[model samples]
Target: MEADLEHYLEPGVGLLQDNASGCAWKNAAGKKISCAARETEALVSDLMVDQPLLWLLVSFSVGILLGKRLFRGN
Candidate 1:
């Protein structure tokens, strides 16, 4: 699934490949940090556990905005 997604994405569009068994982490500014990615994903998943609807809306909005810019024609 990850490979399929990467194939469609343009180069340098924020894909991170974990070099180890653990997932990679990133800072608040979206910069990759030295933390485990699964840990961060778990933390975030826990934080939004009570707001699944809100999370869906926000994710959808952000995806639309990002898709517009990333797939826009030159």
Candidate 2:
């Protein structure tokens, strides 16, 4: 039974062994963080690329706010 289990899990065992020295937990965490960062960056870039008008509106609103504050002395 044990031998059969080992045989069945041979590929998994080999994969674990291969990653043992590198520490799979740290590698997995790093990969996840890297993937999340890449996805976030891609999403932001896509938004900028697809919605220039939206960005323009945001910048215009900010400019208005700043202008109001700066010219409020009058």
Maximum-lDDT candidate: 2
- lDDT by residue (9-71, candidate 2, tens digit) is 757786776568788688999999999999999999998999999999999999999999999
When superposed on Cα atoms, how far off is each prediction in RMSD? 20.0, 8.2
What shift in Å separates residue 22 of candidate 1 from its native position after superposition?
35
Scored by TM-score, the top model is 2
CA displacement after TM-score superposition, residue 37 of candidate 2 (Å) = 1.0
lDDT of 1 by residue, 12-71 (tens): 554344434334442342444435676798888886997788889999999999999999
How much is the lDDT of residue 34 in candidate 2? 100
TM-score of 2: 0.55
Cα-lDDT of candidate 1 = 0.71
Ten contiguous residues with the weakest lDDT in model 1:
20-29
TM-score of candidate 1 relative to the true fold:
0.36
TM-score of each: 0.36, 0.55
